[model samples]
Target: MATEPAPISFARGAPSLDIIDTEGLRAAADRAFTTDPAGTFAYGTSVGYKPLRAWIAERHGVSENQVLVTNGSMQADAFLFETLVSAGDTVVVERPSYDRTLLSLKGRQADLRALELEEDGVNVRAFADLLAGGTDVRLAHLIPNFQNPAGYSLSGDKRRALVALAREYDVTIFEDDPYVELRFSGESQPTMLSLSTSGEVVYASSFSKTVCPGIRVGYLVGDEDLIAKIAKLATGTYISPNMVAQSIVNEFVRGGSFETSIATVKTALAERAARLADGLRAQIPDARFVDPEGGYFLWVEFPEGTDGDALFDAAAARGLAIVKGSDFLLDGAKNSIRIAYSGVTPDEIDEGVTRLAQAYASL
Candidate 1:
């Protein structure tokens, strides 16, 4: 008899659709149809829908002129790179950062220099030294809160220091803060934009992590002049993001459901994070992980000499798939793996961690 495999998944970063608010979509549709159906369907200005921009500014404490809504933060990054990065231009990034950021910059033929990431944040002295030595660096991108694979938040002091370094070096800082609002525990840190009054920080965030990923709504906030430049590029590229989707998000946030939805998702993610951490501790005693205060990932570092690729294969064989840390690094970090707990239920976390333990033991 052929037996079916166990159904356990931890691979994706998307939110479960079951919790998404379709009713908000209906309301948005109604408003669009009733108020200005033709306008909704027509080509929008590349600067994005005006009301959505205003909403974003209000939500993030920036002016509407500073906000340029894009298809998603991924697109936001693309636009920024396209506008700012010349071929062979040097950029600073955190090692083991988001893979997509690496791919985007590489696509532009930009030279990416990675700074070693510490648990608290990127090492300040090393970062300062790079700038102080004048390393032809054009831009520095950082995910300050609940960073992707590392799942570490930058302390307030470090955040300020990094910004100061950027100012000292006359380099632009791309503060990629997609996971800032996902905090399940701990205090929220001040954003680089909040700290910098000179418009040196270009901030990007998304609704994919908090709301439905399908909404495909994210935005960038920066100097009005820089944002206008991005808007020109956006006009040539995407024309404009889905107006209907923007309206949906606007309606959701305005109706107060967005806040409620955030609270709901946070509660579930907190439980899953706790469950996974507990299971990892019990099942793989040798595995070391920093339990994230927020966001969807638990970064587990296996003992030195453990083969991350082999462990990945073994876990996949047991119907549990996870991303090895080496995949996140530009220079290859082979002893860690990023386990995302956001997409799975609490029970699934337990099962996945148990299978991961078995795979680690076998290795």
Candidate 2:
């Protein structure tokens, strides 16, 4: 009997264990305990650890009053959604967005209008048209840099246009950018929050992408009034975010381990992304995808009329796991899939893409 091949997963969008800085984290934890034992152990205010909050504000060029630390970016997202959205409210999102965002908005019973996500970013023209046509849009959520499923960065022109639209339409732009620091190449565009003078952008980001995900530290930066409202809601929900983890993260940054870790992760991800792209092009001539500049996910589309479910099942059978594009959209994208290369090695990426090719052939 022949042994089965080892499973190669391109599913989880997390750093591989080999890339995680365990030793550095341990040191940070020790420093955190020694430097701020009381703050780390106590149930502090809902604003999160003060030091981390201050650091985040300073880094983002915002006042400390505009920041709210949360358990993760997801919690920050939830707070923002609850504060901004009510049933029947209209929210605009990218067609192929992060699935969890769609699920959360759907749970709120908000009317979600998904725009076609292009190579540079969301269709600003379409969005402006929607606004002009009198669709009272409450919020526009975007993944700005290295977007979650598509791995496309919003171009500079699109970014400014989006901010301008938000200002003119009086709609909020939720710039959810956790992978901003993970860019493998090119200069990053200015965040919508930075571009907006009318307080039209609410920015959310997470340390989970650059640091280890287990830390569970994320934050939101926005208008002072808006952040205060969210913070009160956060108080009712969690009393306080995890202070121990925030303190550790603070120490990690203060000690310079954070930058080192980001560099290492970026180098690894760049190699893995390149390998996955090359492998797909070589092994599966029919596979079509835009190369990502710096993020974890790569979106691939097969010929039209292909069944996504059948492709998913086939990939599983071949020990290659991927996310179907249908999960991110309200409907359609039956020929698309998202491959997460962040959690896999370059060698694993090569093998996984080959297995994916086999699965596509089987389909």
- For model 2, residues 1-363, the per-residue Cα lDDT tens digits are 178789888888888898889999999999999989999999999999999999999999999999999999999999999999999999999989999999999999999999999999999899989999999999999999989899998999999999988898899999999999999888878888899897899999999987789999999999999999999999999899999999999999889998999999999889998998999999998889998899898999899998999999998988888999899889977999999999998888888988888888887
Q: lDDT tens string, model 1, 1-363?
A: 177567577777766665566776677667766776655677788777778789889977988999998888899999999999999999989988998998889889999999888888888898888878868689999999889978899999998998888787788999999999899898889998899978889999998876688888899999999999999999888777788777767767777777878888888889988999999889999999898899988788988999999999999988898988887899756889998888888888888988899988888
How does each model score on TM-score? 0.96, 0.99
Off by over 4 Å in 1: 35-39
Error of 1 at 14 (Å): 1.4
Among these predicted structures, which one has the highest lDDT? 2
Residue 253 of model 2: what lDDT? Answer: 84
Estimate candidate 1's RMSD in Å.
Answer: 1.5
Scored by Cα lDDT, where does model 1 land? 0.86
